[model samples]
Target: MSDSSRVAVYLDFDNMVISRYDNLHGNNSWRNDNARDHRPGSGDATDVRLAEAMLDVGAIIDYASSFGTVALNRAYADWSVPANAAYRTQLVDRAVDLVQLFATSGTKNGADIRLSIDAINDLVDHADLTHVVIVGGDSDYIALAQRCRRMGRFVVGIGVTGSTSRALVAACDEFSDYGDLPGVRAVVPTTKVAVKKAAAADAPVETAAAEAGPAKKTAPAKKAARKATAAATKAPTAAEAATALLLRAIRVGMEKSDDEWLHSSSVKSQMQRMDSTFKEKSLGFSSFKAFVESQGDLLELQSKDNGQLMLRLR
Candidate 1:
């Protein structure tokens, strides 16, 4: 089935890739490190590395969006250098259009301008375009989000946290902190802790000695694999599945309705309010939405409205 939502994604290669390295790794060079922050001659290499990194980012999103039924995917960059050759290859592989531009003798590079112009033009031209996703770090695009909203289009900005312009974050309908995106956070080997316990609990005492001895090395590995295999096969239970679906619906409602902070009482009241018959105990849940909230991922308890629980982000 085709998704009803239509979104156009724009990648600003020069601005965002630089953001990954600069914000996370910092300018690797002495010049960038010691130079006055963002000052000329400052060893800041974000500008140098940004273009290459953003190209990869564009390619990834180009692929992800397709699965989500995104209607448009475009990457912006100046393509004179051989360094950007890898970028071009991935862009093509991911079916992204490479919007190329140039720098003139008196003027600066116009990649950002090109990106902005094309985004706005398409927003007006394509009535089906409900959401515009931007891949970039420079705060310059902040105004674009506000402007697009005025024209009645939802704008979603993507960038590493702390690198995106505060203006951009505040202006957009929703900002996907690229840093927190799935598979982006520093992997803490969450399985490691879980594995040791599983091995200790499941292995027979005699086998435990054998396994924890010379064979012990492989025990963690086997336990980890088993855990993963089990997780892959186990579908959410009826109660859990319903909770997960409702949580997503709530998030979608907040996004579409321009309500960033949904009231806790309203959220609790609405689940039951939707159907007076919608009860927690009947669904094998303990306390209505509370039971639902306990089982999901990517959602968190934000606060309370009086005494009720409020959820913010997952």
Candidate 2:
């Protein structure tokens, strides 16, 4: 909590969106298939789902919290553009100061320059700030990061994995891949289910059966209700398999940890370490918390005073 431990975060909004686009499409079929839909030089908003997936501001903030108290948060972008509108409220809700940079003729690096300038200014003016978190993969900020480090401030970098520059990542004291963040989850859309209405004729049969006695009730109805109850209480077989894999991953981390209670974030990191292909989305859960909670029969969850979820096996 001390001023010397304060951390400041800087975000390059356009760079982030472009990086995410590359990660999702990247010269693949998605680009060719959607080329007609997305016209060149349109300056239009990208797909909402892709945008949301790329820059998960909340998840990034939560990840940064593990480092230290975030004292200053700023994001640079041209707010007038319709493409950036969807992300504005998200930034505002998180108290990120939005620095607007309008597009001008023959210039494209204004936002990047502004972000670097603001970061350097914060380093000079804020004596308490000891950490700087740059949330972009652009090589332009490499010099800025070096300057902050030379001033004795620890620098942390965050960027999309494949699209990030290796030099920029190496410039920081620590680097985090945005895709690997705990709360960054891709939700697979669910298929619609068919609904059946109850028939009027069934009402008389139920009434007569009840009037006759409990013995007259159809066995199929009772069996169906019991099956539904059981299904609700217990996870499906495939889900259990996924739960077992999760536990194994966590157990590997538990061996290295000193405490019985581990932060949910740490558990996720361990999961990735154990298996790169493991993703909660593959098991039908949107977040790690949901996946952990699904195995309630085998685990117990408690909220710490700091608001971090602690996991323990039952």
Candidate 3:
């Protein structure tokens, strides 16, 4: 968060997209789906889960945040295609500037070229920039990373573990595997009854009752018995774990800050830091905001004047 450690991030979107797509189709990936497939005549639904599973924009940004204040964030891709277009809103939501590159000849090397040029330009223009974080495993970026390091800027590379090029990882001062990054844990789907029961058990009795005041008054004893029965029926589900993680993070953020409310982003980052594999998508939630809103009974969400969401733990 300091000015002295300003960081700039450049993403080769296509490289990441394809890498994740292949990773999903690889062996032993039972949770893998065909969300990132853009084959001809394929009708892929516009689900946030699919896009997120392909390239977790939130995890990437959160990882970048740990290095320093992210002064510049940009992703290069040809957005005209559905593959890249599907992630536009997500990237924007994370405040990442998109640089669209059109495929002119054989392959769209334009994005790579553009990203390198922009990175150099940013380094030259911004004196405070101390780090250049490149998010892609392509060997083509080796030169870019080396150049940044030669110019006295710390270069960090992020890539999918299996798909990343060895040379690309070696070129940077530090390389982070995307899957190993915080907040990217794979979410395994489980029975809804199990999840519901876990949530009931985990829910603070006073808070849940207070939130359910009207229902409580009608049948307090019966409701309490029902909750007990439900908890006894099943153990904590993945959703419950995810919810608890978020609530714990919100509480931590609130305790640390002077303000009572915690930024949704901060809570998410904290949760991931606590467990790198934690991801809302893993809990069957399309997005973080959706997952938070699903727990409306246990938390209060308010939109701040700055257009950011703040969460108040019940």
Candidate 4:
């Protein structure tokens, strides 16, 4: 896809909220609590527990912006629910169009159908939208992803990790875990206590002799642990990681170029596309050229006859 991408974002708000809740609490805990009946702006709506796992609306939209300008941003959910209403300010602040869907039954919210229809309509109407960002994990979106790709638009999927369907991931051109997005922390699963309790209940009773013997690491295992510790202590610093990223970008740019050397601008664009959050200035460099020159050990830079700078893998 072109670097000058026009992005259209479709967010399934309820799907994200419920998935995040299940990720933090036990599975289906939100449903068990009868979250739908929780009135807007009520005590249940402002529950501290739900706030802990509340989705970061700005983080997702900011990440989408990295692809290109977000021309159309829409979120679908039943706004009457307090859980969804809690995000009204953040959504409005980011200029996201709130598309509300009323619940027809306890289990059947028409978010998926409405979101799909709206996305299709937008794509049909807007020829300039080159990228489609689907912000939900439902397998129902697999067909939408396929259809969007068939229409020559790059489809990006953002979904909660465990709650996301594997089939949906395969269908999209690119897929990102919501937790993995910039400014968002990964959700630590809350099943550890339950797992420990289950293990204790099912654990076999040990004989006196077996209980007396505590397992010891073998000599080889000890040596491996020592090696691993050494490696961890010698882990790459941030500068080294940035240099590696630059080198990889240079290699990719060179591979795609028809000439012997790739333009400096092209390499930088490749880096930004590979990592939307990448910024040479953020790494203490004055400019992209300065950043490239810093990695002199792994890259070669030269000026063309017309004074245009070019780079190649050393």
Candidate 5:
């Protein structure tokens, strides 16, 4: 890829919102709750679970910047809806041009059509744009990806995991799950209380009481719930995550090269490609080498004859 490569990002905002809601809540939960009509910061938009599942727009844009300069970033949505309106501040902060689309019918917001048209037009009009990023998982975008590739432009897709279409993944030059993107924290599953309540609701009254048992039985259940909550809330530390990323990067770099040793710069670049938001400074290291040295047990490092730093998995 050329150093001067330009990228255009087209986001299907509605798709992201609905997909994220369904992923965190139950399937079709967004529609079932009539989330579209809820006032901004009200209803599902402010729900703790939905907030946990919120898409990190800044992270997505940051990852896209890794490829090259993001010259054009546009998001298609019915901004009038509260669900979409909730994201206005973040989108505006990232300088994403919001294209408002009125709902044509109950089910269709015309995002796929509008996004496809704009992406194709941008690709045709700007010869310098070398990368096209489509930020939705609908199979409808298969044709768009095909056309962009045919025009010699690289196509990248980002979508929610279960909600994304497999065909869309095959069509793009690269596909990243939204959850896997850098700076995106994993969504914790539903709470134990919620799960228990749901299960109790389905079971007969006798079974529910039997499962509840006496005070002793209930005491153990409460203790277990507390432990589960603690475990769910305890996220991995920055140093640990960074070390794992470095190890994986080294493994991939070594696999790609015939030599056992991998250059420090190459390994760092691979890490960024895997996670653009990665920075050794964030982990309190002065330099990448310093960070690598901190993981002395997992990595073997040495200076080449020419003073070039190299590393290998220990």
Candidate 6:
């Protein structure tokens, strides 16, 4: 919040941007109706319960102040393509300034060269700067980090794990893999691509929530659902199936043979045992507790210990 506490963010706008977009949002390919209806926030794939689980902004900001006060946050990239077109809005929305560069004719690409020069100039001018966060994996920034280190400034390298140069990290006082960024767990691999086949799906009738996506929603991120489903496979239906399976699974575990009640924790644990990946959200309910309450008639749900839901067969 304070300028002294601020750390400059250096982002590799092109490659990293593409990677995040593809991993979070599905690609425009294929003939899968499920892909269209089940993208992350859509009615079908509304599995992510919390807003935090859906979007991880904290990770992007990174922890610059961890080592020292970051005086400059610069992300380097060439914003000359349509692929990079949408990112402009997102950057501003996040309050991250995108430093635009062109793919030049020389040895050092324009982005790398421009960023390095700017970093050097800042080091010479900003005496209070304690650390410089190089956000790209490109080794071009390595020398700049080294320069900052020689000048007594901590050089913290941040980028995708393995993508960053080990040499660069060793040269700097601290290094953090972008994948290791605080809130971003892992990139979900996109499996169901509707862009290719949906454009070609025979009739392409509005099978599911066809009316919803035209404006406000994106189907569930199949990647998240796939991971969640893989984790929840044994407990209930396939990942693509409804939230009904999870509810029933919990009910089955919580209900006694005589139709007596069971603790909500017992049901939650049972569901988790069936699939460690089973989260109240990945199934599309507001909370694991909410999912239990929604099982009305088939089951009775209540709060016992600390406002947590308890369950029993109806």
Query: What are the per-residue Cα lDDT tens digits for candidate 4 across 1-314?
Result: 36568999999999999888877776888888666455432322224336457687866876676667688999998888777786777787577898867889975689999999999999999999999999999999999999999999999999997899999999998898887775565544323443444446435633543676853423333333344334323446778757755666554444334677888887676566545677878889898889889888877889889978887877
Find the number of clashing residue pairs for candidate 3. 2
Clashes of 2: 0
Instruction: List model 3 lDDT by residue over 6-89, tens digit each.
Output: 789999987887776556444333125443335322212213223334466866775665666778999987777666776665
TM-score of 2: 0.58
Give the per-residue lDDT digits (tens) of candidate 1, residues 178-259.
Answer: 6554323242233335546756765667565765666443444454544533443356676664564455435433533465
Colliding pairs, model 2? none
Q: Is candidate 2 or 5 superior in TM-score?
A: 5
| Candidate 6 lDDT tens digits, 139-239 | 77778888878888656676654356777778777676555554345644333343334334523556543654553323334445455534422343644
Top model by lDDT, which number?
5
After superposing all C-alphas onto the true structure, candidate 1 shows an RMSD in angstroms of: 14.4
By TM-score rank, best first, the candidates go 5, 4, 2, 3, 1, 6
lDDT of 2 at 24: 62
Q: Which of 1 and 6 is the better model by TM-score?
A: 1
lDDT of 5: 0.76
Candidate 1 residue spans exceeding 4 A from truth: 28-68, 105-108, 185-314
> Compared with the true structure, what per-residue lDDT tens digits does model 2 show for residues 1-314?
23246789898887776666556655442344352234222221223224323356766665555455677888887776554555655676578888888776532648778888899898889988888999999888899999999999989899986778899998999887877665466533111010111233356577776687763323333333344334323444756646655675455445445788878887776555334466888878898889898788878899989889899777
TM match of model 5 to true structure: 0.66
TM per candidate comes to 0.49, 0.58, 0.56, 0.60, 0.66, 0.48
Which is the better candidate, 1 or 3, if ranked by TM-score?
3
- Stretches of candidate 2 off by over 4 Å are 1-4, 28-54, 106-109, 187-260, 263-314
lDDT of candidate 5 at residue 74, scale 0 to 100:
94
TM-score between candidate 3 and the true structure? 0.56
lDDT of 6: 0.52
Which pairs in model 4 have colliding backbones?
none
Would you give me the overall lDDT of model 3? 0.70
